[model samples]
Target: MAESEERRGLFSEEDEGDPAPDDQEGEPRTPLSPICDPSHLLHRIVVLAFMCFLGFGSYFCYDNPAALQTEVLQDMNLNTAEFMQLYAWYSWPNVVLCFLGGFLIDTVFGIRLGTIIFSLFVFGGQIVFATGAIVNHFWLMEVGRFIFGIGGESLAVAQNTYAVNWFKGKELNLVFGLQLSMARLGSTVNMNIMGWVYHEVGEVVAAGHTTLGVSLMLAAVTCLLSLFCALVLGALDKRAERILHKEQGKTGEVIKLTDVKDFPVSLWLIFIVCVGYYVAIFPFIGLGQVFFIEKFNFSPANARAVNSIVYIISAPASPVLGFMVDRVGRNVIWVLCAVVATLAAHMMLAFTFWNPWIAMSLLGLSYSLLACALWPMVAFVVPEHQLGTAYGFMQSIQNLGLALIAMAAGSILDTRGYLVLEVFFCACLCIALMAVVMLYFVDYLKGGDLNRSASERARLQKEAAAHSE
Candidate 1:
């Protein structure tokens, strides 16, 4: 009787004294909130830093050849056709290996092993290149460059995929911006340093003071620096992997190569866009020095010097556009980039005869805009698990387009002449504009709004309902 009275007293206090209800069966419970952790933030910063280093190495490899092209041709005693063929050969491996790299990164190595192995290839290729140049063997140098392309292409795929993994929805646009900006810095440094190197070496050769061996040594030193940077990156990647495993309680599966067949239509459209942009861009890079020399009557050194300005502009432009996209929306930034690129291409085609400086400025803006917009969009469309394969496939397609356009551009210049070259660039710009239109259409079809926030919210609500049930 006493125990019963105590229970009644507890119930009476809850029922009569307390304003809050004892049981509210119809009301929903608040979901658990996610807490921000310091470790996660640190991991992201480390990944970003590593990605910047990789960008620096990759761009160094890309721009190094351009700076040394004239010297290489002279040293090897190659004609214009042969030199162009060698350049084409260097790109062919990227066409082949880009997809393979992507699949392997996603399914096999993830970022850690993929990056390490590819770096070895880059280091080895540079060694071979040095040897070839020292021996004055053109074929050997071509072979070295082909090997380098394979590794370099893979490295590029890994870096982009890595960015997706580490950044994701948190500050992703900013990370991509910084990544691209660093790459442009690499290109700028390559142009400035390589120009100086070539000039110094050319003077030495002219004075009969040193052999081509000296230039080869310098190239080898840069390659070693790249390899060292890769090693540091690999160590950091392993640390990140450890942290991820501890946090997630499982290691993520690496992407496999065979998944290319399963890519969504959205990814395929992105691939097409990438191809169109690169096809227009790389050929222009290849021919820019030549054009400046022939059309503007500038010396090779002066032409290369002017070309450096484009890369210099790109270094800052990427980050600014990236920040804008992060704050606003990707679609807005993409459309803006497309508009700028279209205008720049048109300006170049129309006014190269009027003022080369204007054309050069337009070219710089075009490169900066496309780079900032196009690269980050991949992370938006592709799932994290498939990032490697998607990047690889896109790169392969892009490389193929670049190879074809470069060859055609060279041939047209040789056969049909400069008018055909102008026509080709104009056509490429138009195609790129179409790609931008298609992207907008796709976005509209997905929803009227460009931001995916509403969709994400809906998904979360569904998940919460499942958990409650």
Candidate 2:
């Protein structure tokens, strides 16, 4: 009951004052900062730049096994079934831990501490993983990956909390998109470079298998870099809290397990959309190279190269699409557009005789578009305090889907082949389209303006300006 009242109070200030009067046509007014002051806004952008690096190491290390699958198998003397355990280990624990991690952030540890602790998990896990590789202890590596997953997804939740804290309602969409773009860039970099790193290490060691451990150890170096970024970001967040005196201000309601009941129909719809859309993309990409090599008659090298086009395109374009969302504020429209594009991409892959490049590129663009526009909506519906839980729960659900669907898709591929796999992905994407359309209706019933970015920005700016006055 107290929590409900707290939440009501949190959102009740939706239009606390008449908006700051608009300037006349062709009249000049001082350009205002998005938040408390211009200096603070500048600081926020710098924080965002640091936020870009928080997940870099995790992203790089996450796909290392896939990138060097053959080398890892040979180095560990493991068959395909055993090698698959690596991903399972990374994903399984996250399904539960991410939600608890978010809960801890909101109720117990707070964002700064949660980030540092999660980052330590990432760093420590990498060290253990690298050690396992060096010792040819496959179980040890699994343990390392388990620990890494605990940190990886929870750390992502922490990053989302930080983003909402600093950027909510003012380019929040763009910020989330930028963060994802960086993470995807990290993945793309690992895919392109890990093989080279392994080759380079092999040359220096001048041995057949001895270099694999050392090459894998290089990933630990990236994790260490990520830990450093996390620490720095924590300090910045602390300083912002202190200098801005935001601690004593109106804050989010304290989170409770029962608070799940408070999540609106729109948030649930969004969650469903998140799970379905990601199941369509990430799992397919995991198996896509093989699919391409088999179905398109491409050479192994070229197939892998073409499969990478999705990440490469998304890496640079996500932030730009996010900026467009910020400017336009039609988040539902953008999300639906993304779903349509994803469906088109899947249909082309499944049924068409067109160039594969066109299909892959469309998937990339739509992936970027959905990601940027989708995440910020949580900020719109949920208050600041529970942002951690909101993001955490979404990650947990998404990871569960990723873990389950990857296995299912792989099983289907083994039995039925590429066409069947495409059908499965297309089906998930269609569900996402339906979920997104439902979101549009829910937003419309509540007041469609929530889907518009420009008015929200203006309102936030007005609130900030009025508060400053």
Candidate 3:
């Protein structure tokens, strides 16, 4: 009895079952009618919306310096090397801490409270950042970024957990696609609109650090919005779990640090692929504005537009590609194709002076496709209890690579020209392409399950279940 109550407390801290009071002897309880029924599609969709927005604030604030690279330099009186440290600082701690964050999400805080706490950290960190900007203290701003980093990456893990929690087997691929779309949309909105917001803030505030700080301060509003979403989503999830009498997780199965030893080679290869591929995309975008201005002589507005194309295209393409991948079920094949396309895009950027719009557009489509197929593959290989840890390790590895490469890219830009930088990005993509090939062969040896169609996988799962029975 005590163990059962403890398990119940994981979903909600309150006492035994409290009646929902939705069916008050009136007009039947359909999906839309009750609006409170945990099993209803409407409730799940609402939860998914909040899940999308959960990462919006973090994603938006993450690229602030990227969008305003010039202004950050001018306002803080820093060079390119020092400016790149902003991203490095953000990525460095996430190297180790994100894994712990995931473990805590599984063991200590569960999903709901963990999310709220992380949201608060984001909100607080942004405030500190704005204060540093207002005071014109670069170190303070870096400290703020460090704090913000604590929440940002781990919050992503929590968001992923939420998606799996509510929508695991039903439209999960589409759900992941939509989540990535929304996160990238936040980034797109930041790049396009923050410049206008900066100018607007400049009109009222002083022009230098004051204006930059004020603009950054306003970003807190988005963090606040995310916090609200986290709170409401927690409440809704708790109620849903209670009403459905779901076991949030197996009470007896606890996460252990030693369990990582059990992870297969395929999962580690995915982590490497994530690290190899994204270092090219993200660090490039971080410094892309300057590359455009110098290499192509694009005006700042045009540079911002071209630089933002990847995210803009992702907003619509992710879901469509995700739905297609779901039907096709060759996730590894999709990943391979996406990596090859990305490699081609980087090659064009390196070898030609052709219109960057074409290169960026191709890159954008390729990234959307990779995102559609890559993440959900983890769910297939990992046990349900350890999904959080697997995701955390993936994020951590990716961040470590980003931290090192972002600093290197900045230094390379400072010393060598843009051409060399493009070559470097191309090389990273090559590594990604090779990793994907290796992953494919490895999974093929393990029954070719990774490349099988959805119907085939479903049939296999049923067979395995019957065999076990």
Candidate 4:
């Protein structure tokens, strides 16, 4: 009860105001530095940039396998089963660990500390992966991926927590979209640049296995960049807390594990959309290089480019779509449209002989729109305190589906071929579409906050606060 009362009217303020009454005492507020002024938009944009790059290393290293799919297979002599394990190992552990990781963010490490630690996990894991590749040890690489996975998903939770803590009532959707853009930027870079990195390193390493490993080791540089960002962001957050007269430690609030059973049905529906939709995207991208090669009869180079199209387009499109959603003010409608567009893209890939460039471009734009619409809604359904746990649980489930479906995707491609795999992806999107429709109704019955325009939501919040007085 103390926690509940303390959390009231917290983390929702988007503009500068006085500290809590007890916080201010019988004294007037002190002047803030120009940099510390809450009204400073430039300072916030700088922070937003840091938040955007927080996932850079994780996204870059994740698609390393996909980027080097042909190379890893040929150089390491790995079959589809072994190659897919790289992704499976990374995702499988996150199924449970990331949920606990999120809880830890709320209870023990707090967001700043948890983020730093998780980034460290990602860095260390990638090193292990690069080492395994250099030495030609698949098992060691699996272990590296396992460690990387531990930090990767939890790092995302910490990122979400940071975003809500800072931008919850402001342009939260734009922040989420921008974050997705930077992360996808990481992925796009990996896809386009890693091949070049491999070729360059192959000169010294003389090609084959060590070239792949060395390239991955070079890829670890982005992880280092992200770690630096984390450290700087932590310092910034600490400084902001002091200057803003915001309370620390008590700020994260508590989210007990037992609270999961009480989460809203709307949140669960969103989770279904999360897992069902992404299993199609990520897994398809993981296996997509080969898919394009086989189905479209493209060269290896062209296939990699096509496989990268989603991230490339999304890198730019996500922020734009996000701004549109912010302006339009109907998140549910945007999500549904994104889902339908994705389904259409998949169906085109599955059945039509049309140019894949068109399909991939449409798919990328729709993906951006869905990401812009979907993620920030969690912040609305759950209280600020529960944000970490809620985001963690959602990611936990998504990784479970990724782990299982990635392997299945590999098998389907091997045995049933690319056509069957595309169909499988289509099926997952169909499930996501249905879930979005159900979410629409459920959110409606609960007063429609999720679908409300920015003005409407702000009006309702003000009324609720006034009534609580």
List, residue by residue over 1-469, the lDDT tens digit for candidate 3: 0011111112221112222343444556345454566666787788888988988999899888888888898899987778888899888878887657756677888888999999998898889988999999999989988888888877876776676567645455567667777887888998888888899999998899999999999988999989999999889888776556564421222335576898999988888788888888988998888888887899877888899999899888867876788788998999999999998998888888999999999999998788768877776787867665666567667788989998898888888877888899888888888889999999999988778898998899899999999
Clash pairs (backbone) in predicted model 1: 106-254, 106-255, 107-254, 107-255, 107-256
Query: Please, what are the lDDT tens digits per residue for candidate 2 over residues 1-469?
Result: 0011111212323312222223324465456555434235676777888888888888888877777765776778865446656776788887787557646776677888888888899888887877788877889988998888888877776766666666655465567667776787788887778777897898788544457768878888888888898888877766555444454112232435566778988899999998899888876766666567668887655666677788899778866876677688888899899999999999999998788999999998988788767877777887666665676577667778877886787677667878988899989988999999888988899887557668777888799999999
The candidate 3 region of ten consecutive residues with least summed lDDT is 1-10
Stretches > 4 Å off in candidate 2? 1-51, 73-84, 102-113, 134-137, 158-178, 204-211, 231-254, 262-264, 297-301, 379-389, 440-469
Sort the predicted structures by TM-score, highest score first: 3, 4, 2, 1
**lDDT of every predicted structure (CA atoms):** 0.59, 0.73, 0.79, 0.79
Q: Tell me the lDDT of model 4 at 399.
A: 78
Top-TM-score structure, candidate number: 3
lDDT of 2 at 210: 59
For residue 453, give model 2's deviation from the true position in Å.
8.2
TM-score per candidate: 0.74, 0.75, 0.85, 0.82
Q: Candidate 4: where are CA atoms >4 Å away?
A: 1-51, 110-112, 160-177, 234-253, 376-389, 439-469
Off by over 4 Å in 3: 1-33, 36-47, 164-175, 235-255, 379-389, 443-447, 453-456
Worst 10 residues of 2 by lDDT: 1-10
Q: Record all residue pairs in model 2 with backbone atoms less than 3 Å apart, i.e. clashing.
A: 329-453
